[model samples]
Target chain A: MSLQESGPSLAVVGVTGAVGQEFLSVLSDRDFPYRSIKMLASRRSAGKHLTFQGRDYLVEEIAPDSFDGVDIALFSAGGSISKEFGPIAVEKGGIVVDNSSAFRMDEGVPLVIPEVNPEAVAGIRAGSGKGALIANPNCSTIICLMAATPLHRHAKVVRMVVSTYQAASGAGAAAMEELVLQTREVLEGKPPTCNIFKQQYAFNLFSHNAPVMSNGYNEEEMKLVKETRKIWNDKDVKVTATCIRVPVMRAHAESVNLQFEKPLDEEKAKEILKKAPGVVVIDDRAANRFPTPLEVSNKDDVAVGRIRRDVSQDGHTGLDIFVCGDQIRKGAALNAVQIAEMLL
Target chain B: MSLQESGPSLAVVGVTGAVGQEFLSVLSDRDFPYRSIKMLASRRSAGKHLTFQGRDYLVEEIAPDSFDGVDIALFSAGGSISKEFGPIAVEKGGIVVDNSSAFRMDEGVPLVIPEVNPEAVAGIRAGSGKGALIANPNCSTIICLMAATPLHRHAKVVRMVVSTYQAASGAGAAAMEELVLQTREVLEGKPPTCNIFKQQYAFNLFSHNAPVMSNGYNEEEMKLVKETRKIWNDKDVKVTATCIRVPVMRAHAESVNLQFEKPLDEEKAKEILKKAPGVVVIDDRAANRFPTPLEVSNKDDVAVGRIRRDVSQDGHTGLDIFVCGDQIRKGAALNAVQIAEMLL
Candidate 1:
């Protein structure tokens, strides 16, 4: 299909989800080229009406036939749902861009971050399935690797030890509400019930929220470790992560220590990160200025700061940087929409 | 001295400060033996009356002679005051347990974390001008080493990567208040300002609060690196840490990944951790139960769970443990008082 001739048709699966909603907003804001829009969800949300670009559309129950006339499909539902129905959506002639981890590590599938590896998507149509499935990086990894990948181009990343300060949005809409409810409950002098989380999410922090694997890494931490390696396509890159959930609602923050294969001066490191795409440099030590979740929440650009050398090593050429990005937008929704836009 | 015999009096310096007040509470709660009690502070807080042991004591200005009859003096005011008056307190025949980092890392002085290395206090004596300056470990290090040291006893320690979810109390009382005030401002639709912290302390989490050294490790992160080695007394211990402040108040939590010289099995690791003193085993994965800040905030014992093996590395045992203990108690004041108990 020529860009000037037939416009693309987009289908949003899991239209009622947090990321699904972002897909709608990004398509509208970015003016993605689309002839028709179809919204699909679970049977419970089917028949619900939503409007995009001033046009009303009905949310239909997701089925094999849902993507018949669709050119692209965005999936942000759980992994089980994606696993059960992703191939069916692709079989119906729609290229699927899945946000879940279902097909992320599959050797045949392409795991992509548009800014990092756009060339990987060129062969999306030359696959065994009807359409290719592109995996979106995990929320924390997407936020950190966006800033790290640009720096990695200048210096080969030897290893990264990341500790994430994640927001409730990474867990989902229910976890977000749990934070609010738990906060209010604590304020009202009532005991907080650990429903959405294993512990109280009000005025508290936990090292692990997702189920911990036998590897001593929680689901969240493992996501950061694996997804970053896949997106950067550097399997030998050593990445260790500790993911923690804080009481924040939106932006996710990561403290990253990157050891370079060769010495890179602190000044050159800062300069490289400053000119990086989709990154805002905010390193002012005298003014106590640095990238923070409070500043980056709801913002599009990933904020990077605290650029300095790592002192523990004798040679001391390694740099430490902190990155913060909105978990909802750039991390999930906006990234998925950008993938679809690549095809357009 | 017998229990009924008169002993030299003890002084609590900086009684109004965060750690100072906690020392006062710990002294009484633990029933430390003292002939008399003297509460001391700066000029601003002097003359205020504080009650301990059902008796009121006057807060006096910290002077060179304030340690006249003080056999044991606990100091937490700041580094400068400790540097200026620590020797004077020692000259007056007082054993000083200094909580500040002033004398820590000094070749002559010993940094004591009672749980890790109580024998470090054996050097405390009255005759030397050294004044028995026992240093307390940094909060993050205190929490991390508490969990790892027990594991190290069974397996030789080699490398450790820890990510800290630190509480505002680790900063000071003002930082705690700033988190509360800024959170209220954010909820009320007002843009919160960074006052006590470098950025908004409310509804946010960020990594680089302490000065990031030229080595890429922030002051907070370096504390974890240096202090962990000191407390464990193993310079060969390779430690990499990322310290982050979350929207939490009192308890400091850590996610630790430790590599042992000898690989460990899960059952043996659990058995060792279960019998470890000051450590509570809460690893019940089936019921989704684990140690949490809400359960350990006011407690002295460090709560640990998620004991498992490292799937990422071969022949390296990994345990995903979440540890939480009151920063004000175990991390600072109570720890200093515990060191004092060793002296008496």
Candidate 2:
């Protein structure tokens, strides 16, 4: 029986990693069509077993031949792994949707947010016989732009200042476990086990662990800056970001200040965001309820609140917003799956 | 025995609250001279016993006559308690160093940050046989200004943007206990206990619990904006803030962006902060170490790091920095004690 009879054959690289596992969950949740599936991971996890949609699968070591017959490949391993295997998968006639920073800034590779810039992957399809590479923006950038873009379209955003309260899940599943273990140890009057991070991760927060660039912006913060420019396709838009890792499990919250080229009042900006797709408004001034990381822990939609005019700016020229989104879902797995769906 | 033999007689109001306890600790730590001391609280804690400097003391119920013959009083109860009793203490000839927001914006009260604006209370002395009131700025404002004021002095900051990651101690002792309990409960696969806050606060964060105003800025946020102007004595300075409550125990972290009228490079800003009193520089780019709340938990000096030129602005006219300071130490009790020390 031909695997392509009902739908495309699929391969999931880094199937044992955090986002890799999430990719499978998102695919199953979305009921993505697949005739046959291959689970690929590093040599250490090659013999592991995983079940998806009541079907059992044995993980295989990733090799050059892994993508030989694959139609669409989802890559979520670290950047170095993606760097080594991404091109090979494409060369093997598999369309690659990568969740690493490997080729996000590559000139010819289209960095896409399906909700914001679906047209970036205009003609690429699973059955087109031509293999293509699509890069997923960084999680902070994806979560920020998901809320900022709808308003950016209504009034051109000239500058944006973002401060992120990121979650442990952005680091990986192991880091989330480390946080829990550390919290338990600290509560018991024992020194916390600091395996995933160098310092204490429970009941504490710190700057992002990404390496600091020469300009003093960490890799994580610069990703927000550069990815916003690329995804919006507007090089003139200016951005600055301060990324912090909080102790939350899986969701991220950002405080964004936007300076626009045109006047956009708070009421009008709220109206625009209300009609925007994939965005939920939780702003209730009377109830004092706004979007929070815990409230959006496992949700797919990005929540935006604290909508108000920037009092420091000239009348109606700037707005301040708070946003929360599940880092592993909309920020990573769900975003990549949406890109693959566009290809179908 | 005359109680005024060595120094002024002192009174500590709200002696059972978190900041109130910190007040006693700081006074003892500083070897503050006091001939007589009174521990006063509400009726709920009237019979409570507290030990200070190896001496046992009973908490007395606060009354209008509680301030009689008292040379200085430190108030940290809620706003209404301070509003009703603060002037009463002053009327009884005791100088009041208030840690509440009751008189922060009053026309005659001098809002003081000892490190930044000690001169505002030059003439108010504890033993002048005259009563006075001094206001301590909010914790978020105190932490932000500790780092920003030095740069603002050199380059004349025209606009400032701040985002805060606050701790549970700002809500009081019960809130801190609630956070610990909720964390333990959540780890045990049970619903978290939600008492101090309406939502789960373990491994999660939310916007500040301050009442949201009509303009969409919460009271905690407005305090930062308004207090900066009052403390700096700069009515024209533009300030905006977003206040968030993180799961941290005691320290508050702030990300501040400054736009200055004069050009100030990152190096110069670093030099200025290095010489600024009550501020420490922790900007180690190679080690990827910046200020974190855990590192600053009980520290008296505010830690500043992540200092960089704002790429979004032109030619050294703007910069960004991250700051962390203990909410109870430098933010509240320590600041009030410093104000009282100035009166000596």
Clashes of each: 6, 0
Docking class of 1: acceptable
lDDT of 2 by residue, A270-330 (tens): 9999988889999999998999998997789999999999999988999999999999999
Top candidate on DockQ is 2
How far does residue A256 in candidate 2 sit from its true spot (Å)?
0.3
lDDT of each: 0.78, 0.93
Q: After superposition, how far is residue B24 of candidate 2 from its true place, in Å?
A: 0.6
Local error of candidate 2 at A136, Å? 0.6
Chain A accuracy of model 1 expressed as TM-score = 0.94
Worst lDDT window (10 residues) for model 1 chain B? B1-10
Place model 2 in a CAPRI quality band.
high
- Candidate 2 C-alpha lDDT tens digits along B288-320: 999999999888999999999998897899999
Instruction: Please estimate how well model 2 matches the true structure, expressed as its whole-model Cα lDDT.
Output: 0.93
Q: Supply the DockQ value of model 2.
A: 0.89
Ignoring the other chain, what TM-score does chain B have in each prediction?
0.94, 0.98
TM for candidate 2 is 0.99
